[model samples]
Target: MLPALSTLAAPAPALSTANTGFVLICSALVMLMTPALAFFYGGMVRVKSTLNMLMMSFISIGIVTVLWVLYGFSIAFGTDFGSVVGWSGEYVGLSGIGLTELWDGYTIPVYVFAVFQLMFAVITPALISGALADRVKFTAWALFVALWATVVYFPVAHWVWGAGGWLFEMGVIDFAGGTAVHVNAGAAALGVIWVIGRRIGFGKDPMRPHSLPLVMLGAGLLWFGWFGFNAGSWLGNDDGVGAVMFVNTQVATAAAMLAWLAYEKIRHGAFTTLGAASGAVAGLVAITPAGGSCSPLGALAIGAIAGVLCAMAVGLKYRFGYDDSLDVVGVHLVGGVAGSLLVGFFATGGVQSEARGLFYGGGLEQLGKQAIGVFSVLAYSLVVSALLALVLDRTMGMRVDEEVEISGIDQDEHAETAYDFSGAGGGAGSRRAVPAPDGLPATPGGPASAGRPAPDSTGTDNATGTAPHPKVDA
Candidate 1:
């Protein structure tokens, strides 16, 4: 008995270390998503704020990195003080918490676990910027990011994943981050759009994308990294990696593509490149929470549902008159809802234990739990994000000067340009204009470069056709 107690007290090797390693790898993959996101979003906007577009993503990496290290994780994953928040008991300043593992039946480094989790923390807010693109001020955005992460993101994360977390106790299975990351981010995107108001020109402008190839490249990278994002959520590599998740990702995306194109064919009469990208992303979002939970056929149905819903929901901004410039609210939010709710019905067996869905005879219990969790998270995130946005808007202001906006925030704010390809400035300071993310310039009829030569702006263009400047909001 004495020997047994001693052995038990000696502390088994940290299972969460393996958890940490896998998480660390997945986290790095998720971090790669930010740059991938930069290209994705950058390609969707006008050429004027191309650098600013990229900066929004890069800034989140910076802002959330600091905040997460500080107290973001504490408030998020610390011991629960109540259902709404976590206490500041562990991982503060990277102290005592790393000595023990954070997961069960895995031997991974605790610090590794923290860092892997940290990567997820960094990307969530960046995903919301899709809506408020091209107008928000840099300093205001930074402050808003800090506050949003703390007040909104932290609490919600706590409720879902932290010890004594309500959602965990309630038996809701997230798999990855359907309600926590995507849904929460989506709702916040809507709230921020409401608070910040529309862009300088809303429906009146012909804001076309400047570079389709760049957008596609970003999508490709996201696809590659997402294998890590979803499969890695299992906390360790397993035989399942090459099985259900891999197939589900493919079929769901394919189904969504078909659904979107068919919808466009019936409604708009043309399958625009933008529509294709949006559809693919919609499927990806819907599949996130259901990665390993349901059968491929179920995933297909979920993808079809999400593709149709998100494609339609995107128009809500226009009808409602909010300027979510990039549709973060539409795709991520709507798709997240569809995925999470569908999994509740379509799950193969038990609650987080792969509870069967409605069609699978799991009854309404799981579905009800899913609905409760989704709306609760949505409401919580919307309220917190709105309050944070208003705080920043009132205190420091959220938009740039109108004149600066017209001239382009890159020139007005960052004082540097993204392209110098043509030697337009001659010596050092002159530059040129660029195409929008999906646009290609008609250079004397040869296959056009996406960047058009601006008479006086920075004449820099990346390998893609974009002529961007590395300017954040000012």
Candidate 2:
């Protein structure tokens, strides 16, 4: 009977080609975020390993994109087996479900939804790499990511998004993946830092960012792509509803940016570019779960709240001795929770299709559901992520050998360099970098230049440079 009904299902039955086009565009926009993430994270690392860090995000695109087609979608959105997870039957091997899919009355091509979701899969785990930067064997890290996707990410995703998943059955309202994406990834980053341990010379040295503009650039791209993330959740531009989400996304992001900078200036005595970027991310994270649920004003409040809370999260490691080096845990996990629970309190005023939070007098029911969603993802992610880290550590080791640790991964792992402006010259490699476009000699550690190159094992030029990029260690 199921097979007979499946044959009767029409192609593109629930939506039109026009709607599929919109979803396709949105999915593409989300895919761009991985590269944007590359710039955001790449610029933060020492020049020696910039490519290596950026590669992490890129590899995710390669690995998870394939996995999603194979069974990731099944594991996540398939029919529920009992009450805990799905049966992998909704669209086996991407069969039966094609150009027509009814995610609701508003449907699109199944492939459109599949491709759109694949981008999310690629990015979530990639975010964790920032925590254990500048160390860990590449091969070990690669295998670890694969294992992690199946063991940790898939099951949790099932619980949150799958029809049969317990969280979904309980009516947890995570419109854009608060628990599934941000909280899950953020908590896992914490687990990674725990198992991988600190970077070499962590506290002993200044450990400053190598670039600021790169950070800003990344933030800019993420900001642009986020329109797709928030607005596209509706699957089309067919109505004022999606337009509202788009506007709310921008307003909330701006509010969060302001809040982050305000707090930082008051606490640190300077308005930092990095802080601004991170604040934008915090706003984006906070609004994600609440995007479909909040009014513009409520979104503004949510963004502001997230910024302040996440700003405080950055200081957690210093106070508690846990090394969430990049604060993935601090910002995403914390901000996502703030948005997730708070939405229950503020879902009033033009948010009917949305759930109401307790603050608006909805009482404890929604809040309790939100809390359960957060803790379940947090607990499951933390435990599974820790086990993966341990497996990598126990089997092939986590951190690289001590001597390799001292050298950058680009040199040791990739056997390459980021910049080669000098090219082989006069039978000896010239260590001198090119002059600035303004005809000024590049200065190491200079304001206009990437941080000065550290002396190499052989004292050659271009050895251990801190290229200006957008990365901030927590």
Candidate 3:
């Protein structure tokens, strides 16, 4: 058995070099997921909004990391308060947590654990960015992240994983973050979008993803990083549970990808790259909570189900008339709910926890518990997120001007473009703007027009008909 933590000024306890090293590596891997998410969401937006999409996810790393170091970590993992929330001020600035202090029952230092969980805190809010893509203000988004992380994420994290958390006490089986991460973010996405309303051209425009290759690349990164996210939650390398979770993750993802393709082939008559990427993510989200609790076959069932369901769910935004720009609500929220609840029927006592599902003769008890956890988080996140968005919308405004949106958010918000049509990269002096065969205006933020000396500060070339930055009218 491990020894109790030593008192202040005492020599640090001997560390488990293996577990410590493993968690550190896993922490680094998890950190990579936020940027991976940026790419995943970035590739889905139009060229004009591409960088803004990337920024929405990238900024979470900055905002949440600072908050985590201050009180985010403390509220999540600090002393518990009635199991409803942790004391946010107790570990203010991580004051009492020492560098050498070992986390209970783990070989890693408390600081390492804090940082690892911090990665989760960072990405949870970022997940909502995709649903609001193309229309929201960057400043408003940054502020929302700060507020949501403090108000929603930190407290929820405590309920799920913090010592003495209510859900932990109630025996809810969230191996990773089926509830805290995916469901919470998914519900929150739905709420914010409701308050922000639909995108300007919703339904009328095609709004296809700008770059599928980037989407594929982002999906690949998410798959690679998810191994760390799921298995790393074990907090050590000593047990077989991490390996089980790792393999479960792989099998479930493959099954979901194939299942999604099959469903698409039947419904849409063709398999697309976007479908494959979305299916893979659906699988990843589904198995996150159930990975350690089920067998390989159980993982397959979970993945296939999520793939089929989420593909269908994505269309709900259009049919129901609510815009979830990037399907964050469809994939993460729906898939998360499926995974968490399904575990109640598939969980095996012999795998990770002693809990057995109905299929294994454990009956409906566990399933009831799972439902309570899922809906509670879903309802709470949905209500609170909408309130936050409404407050922001009323005060400083949450969306960009219509003119700026039409011209492209990247150029207007960031004062830069993702692509330059000027042929400047290939050594060609300049290019003239040419209208597309569609007879629409040249893409406002598209490649530069030829025969123009250069774009002026306003992002337009007067010599040619190219307008990189269209004028925004009040």
Which ten residues in a row are the worst by lDDT in model 2?
Answer: 458-467
TM-score of each model, paired residue for residue: 0.85, 0.86, 0.88
**Evaluated with lDDT, which candidate comes out highest?**
3
Ranking by lDDT: 3, 2, 1
Q: How much is 195 displaced in model 3, in angstroms?
A: 0.3
Q: Between candidates 1 and 3, which one is better according to lDDT?
A: 3
Worst 10 residues of 3 by lDDT: 459-468
* Model 2 ranges off by over 4 Å: 1-13, 99-104, 349-354, 424-474
lDDT of 3 by residue, 1-474 (tens): 666655435664467888888888988988999999998888877767888999999999999999998888888888899997777464678777777778977778888888889999999999999999889999999999999999999999888888898888898999999999999999999999999998886766556667779889999999999999999999886779999999999999999998888877776666777889999999999999999899999999999999999888887876788888889998999999999999999998777898998988899988888898899899999999999999999999999999988767887788766766643432123334555444455643233442232222122111000112222211
lDDT of 2 by residue, 45-119 (tens): 666667778888888888887777778888877777776655556566787674555664456766787777777
lDDT of 1 by residue, 278-326 (tens): 7888888889887677888888998898888887887777677778788
User: What are the Cα lDDT values of the candidates?
Assistant: 0.75, 0.75, 0.85
Task: Give the winner by lDDT: 1 or 2.
Answer: 2
Question: Any residue pairs clashing in model 3, and if so which?
Answer: 421-447, 421-448, 431-449, 431-450, 432-449, 432-450, 433-449
Clashes of each: 43, 14, 7
lDDT of 2 at 257: 93
